[model samples]
Target: MNKIKQGIEKLWAGPWVPPEHGKMPYFWLLSLAYMGWKYAYVAPGALELAMLVLTLALFVPLYLASFRARGWQVHACMLAGCLFGAAWVRWNPGAATFFIFACAMAAGITKMKHAMLAIAAVIALALLASLQASGNMRFLFLMPILTAGLPVGVGAVMDARLRRSRQELLRKQEEVEHMATIAERERISRDLHDLLGHSLSLIALKAELARKLVHRDADACAREVGDIEASARQALAEVRAAVTGYREKGLASALASARASLAAAEVALEENVERIPLAPAAENVLALALREAVTNVVRHAGARRCSVSLELEHGVAVLRIADDGQARSAADIRHGNGLCGMRERVQSVGGKLALRARAGLELELRVPAAVSSGMNP
Candidate 1:
């Protein structure tokens, strides 16, 4: 039943020509000539047989010539051959009727210029013959011109519409691809933020607390060391999240990270404003920036204390992490891949990040409210 339905659909779908398929009209004409010889002219008059054989012979070269000519040239040659055959048949002088049939076939292959020329030639011959003979000139000459011109005008209009439709489809496809790229980038940014932010913050806090207790309480210091180890494991998980581009980081989670990381570094954290909600992309970038900045402080800064702050100011969320470590030399302050990655993340969301050393090494990140509101908790 399915096969029957498919066959029916194919019947309605029209003929499917292969890409390499070339001129078909000439092949069909050859088939007609074979049929004429076998069935149409077995008992024909002697002169009629010769004329039919000659017309059949002419079809071979004329069919080959049609493939080589472009535009109206192909039609012009075919029309000329048909007119020659019509004259040879010597049907009635009034019945150059085959020339009209030839003109119609030529019109299908000819461009406007060649078609006009063929039409003019046919009209001129018909008018001259009509002056000598007696038949309606208007029906033969005027009607063919009007009929042949219709296809050329319609073909030109359809060609223009097809070109415009193709261009519009390409434009729409490009727009869809561009939008998909942007959405993918944003999704990646959000995932990285959620994965790494909390772990790094916890590690910083444990490290800071450990530093403070080292002299006064060795056992308490050991506990802080254990916490640091746990934080490192969490950081490992976050790193995997960043790599995989899954998960979403929330503002509260990022704040918890800041507190943990600063505490581990023995840095004092100050918060001046209430929690501000952020878009997942903004939160992720901001969290990653915080992680990089704090990691830099722990690794390079000889500072005993650091300060971490998050505030909403002028419709932007601002994050500042500063350390009282010795100011980095210009050479030491040069950015690594981690810092560059953080900068790129911020920039992707139309935010700004700056790293500098005033009295101390400071990393500042500011994200606009428009970007910060879309984050998932």
Candidate 2:
């Protein structure tokens, strides 16, 4: 008994389960009990009785295993189960439970139209056989309808409901996934806008500065042109970094590039920068903003001297970049792409950008010192 229990337990251990777990065991047990009741009265010869029992034993495992079988294999087993079921039902016309079981199983696994049509043909022939043997018209017609058609109808309704629910769930899942993809793309777009706006402005500044310095400081101009080439190459990696959401080129590199651009323009630069801590994102945005401001100094401002400073004050980091350079037309100063982008980036990190362009191009950026901790930066 212990070994028999272990064998049954082993059968239940794998991924195989009937249509609904914990319910199908009753189906098989009740089916056997029903067949046993009818087989006793039908009492064929000993050889015929052996065949009936053998057929039941052989088909039970194959029918139960059909749920786990794939493709043509499961269908093949289902057809075999149906034929065996019909044979049993025909042998003892009173044992019509097999007809119900076969119809229900077929309805559960197959398309509704196909299952009903196929089951209709099968039961019609079986009903004719039972009709000839028993010669009872009412029993042949009404009994098969009660046994086979009722179960098939119930199974088809339940299967159709299950399929509809599964399809609805899959559609919702796909919709959520598509929305996530769109959100990620929009975020990357904002980051790209922040990143490229300042970097490209600086490159343009240095190239223009170098062109002017070619007559004044030939060696210094060559160095500025070299910086522009290096920056353009580095821009390639920045784009990839923006995609991965791990971009971090901070204030130090931007200031270094600024000094070079200023020198090429023959503008004396005064600096006061410190080792300050910030989130990689905050630092990167601040740095890019500085690049843009310095570029404006070189390009638009005709300042003889520029001043750059970064310090912590009032629990925030304030970066001040000013140059006694040329003033701008109201149209270009207010709505410039570089300045607009700088404001957007600084604001994203709870920072502010102030422009003091009336006297000279003075740009100030301020952000909470701890703002970096709140961002994925």
Candidate 3:
């Protein structure tokens, strides 16, 4: 009996069984009830029940498989099942359900016009079969329209909504990509302006002075030439600072950039940084985090002064960045991609970010020592 039950289970749910309390199994039972509704009034004979079981065998596999099938395969399964159901109608009135299922499949696979045309053809064939075997001619014609209408209409609407949703998602993706390209251009422009502006101007002035002094004082001319070389080296350092973004130049380089940026923004910055030995990846994360924190302070905090401090305690690294400007309300702080990105970067390294606006705007970022030592999060 147990073996028999297991075999029945395998057959009903397929050899590869779906999860427990599955909707697909319930749906199959509903289909069976729909196709056997006529027999609810009168008891079906043994032969009729046998034919019912046979029809179920043909219907179940094709119906379940149609969900994941595509293109002509889905159409083929629907057509095959519809034919079986329509044929079963010779012995039963309720077998009209297969045509309804087929209508839905058609509607899902193609546009409304094509689905309606295909359903119409199937309805005509079913109507002819009904005319031959049906006891009630009026019902035979009327029932198909009523049953097929609901599934087909619902399927068409669902298809349209799905198409619209896909289009909307695609539009959003494209918009994000365009914004990223614009941001990249702006970053490059800003970096170049900051990097070359001061150095280039000084180099040009020193070169002109050296040209003027060439006939007057040999010693002064050599000094101006030395100044030009120094200016060139300074320009190279600025370029290296921009490139340090990917090179993991650690907290010192990041702090230098932050100081320069803050000065550019007319914001006074105070720093208290302690040297902490961290793995390269951890250093890079902290550096990027410092850069982002300073950027937010400069752009949104509207603070006249900012301070940054780093410390280590109990196998954890703590960094704090605070600004004097609390112009914007904390309630208005929506953690857009910027803050969300910061959070993600921190969390990926087994760290957490804390934000508070009571005493101006402050950020506390913490990283575990395990992560800093190159351990996986």
Candidate 4:
């Protein structure tokens, strides 16, 4: 039962057809009511009935096939529909509906020049058919030309607009993906630098000391070498943890990264961070919030000079980022996906985000500074 229902549906609403149109393609077949009216008055003879059935058999396939056809194939389908109407119109006026369908399908053509040419050809064929059948150019005879030509013009314009909309959406999606890729790469590079920079420098310094003390003090030399080995092992472990996606660069590394990023964007940064102690979790949240705020400044704020400050007030950590960029009204500051995500992350760590629009944008984050006993830096 389901298979039969699906097959029936496929006859009109094929996979390529958008569901929003409903059953409009099938509903439009009611325009063939003229043939039934003609039959009610005079009755269709056996040969006339046969011709009608054959016309329907051929025309229905062409009409449905138009949904899936493209380029020259669409042109061929339109031409076939026009020819069918021209051939059948002499016996029955109801066949003019074929002309409407044929020209409507011309909308699928993308090129303006080609679509115009195709519509013109359909109109010419319709004109010739109507004139030949009526034997004269009367107002009634011109109905076929008007009905067919209007659909081609209107449908062509609609199709062009839909095509442009889809292209624009695709272009924006690509841009977003590219930006995300760049952000991920920058994050990995920054993490690597933060993890290795201090340890590598200390190891280098210890190795130099050991080389100098080798002859003068054997015990000092051995101690320096052991310290160098320990630093090397620690650096290796940190790198391994970084590779496994452990991105826990503390507040210091975050500020360093912000400086580099701002400098690259030609935006000067001023920092006044207190040497306050914070738990790892609190530091991570603040660092992420700081990074996001600075990134927004560089990418969207267009600020020349940015200020960053971290302060401890009543057991809460306050981080403020302000810039001297283009000013926008409060309503103009939309919390887009990036800002929304930043807010979510901050909130997850029991932090609050506040925004202010002055000469430029100012973002402030407040997180609890859960100071551990041994966390003095």
- Residue pairs with backbone overlap in model 4: none
Reference-based lDDT, each prediction: 0.59, 0.67, 0.67, 0.72
Comparing 1 and 4 on lDDT, the stronger one = 4
Reference-based TM-score, model 4: 0.49
- Using TM-score as the measure, the top candidate is 1
Tell me the tens digit of each residue's lDDT in model 4 across 244-285: 656445677667767756764668889888887887767866
Off by over 4 Å in 2: 1-225, 326-332, 371-377
Model 1 per-residue lDDT tens digits across residues 89-192: 22333233334434434434434565556645654555444443334433443343345434533453344356456779999999999998886776566455
lDDT of 2 by residue, 269-302 (tens): 9998866777776787777787777767766667
Evaluate model 2: give its lDDT. Answer: 0.67
Backbone clashes (count) for model 1: 22
| Superposed model 3: Cα runs more than 4 Å off | 1-29, 137-144, 147-154, 157-175, 178-186, 189-377
Q: Is candidate 1 or candidate 2 better by TM-score?
A: 1
lDDT of 1 at 195: 46
For model 2, what is the error of residue 317's alpha carbon versus the real structure, in angstroms, after optimal superposition?
Answer: 1.8
The prediction achieving the highest lDDT against the true structure is 4
lDDT-best of 1 and 3 = 3
Global lDDT of model 1:
0.59
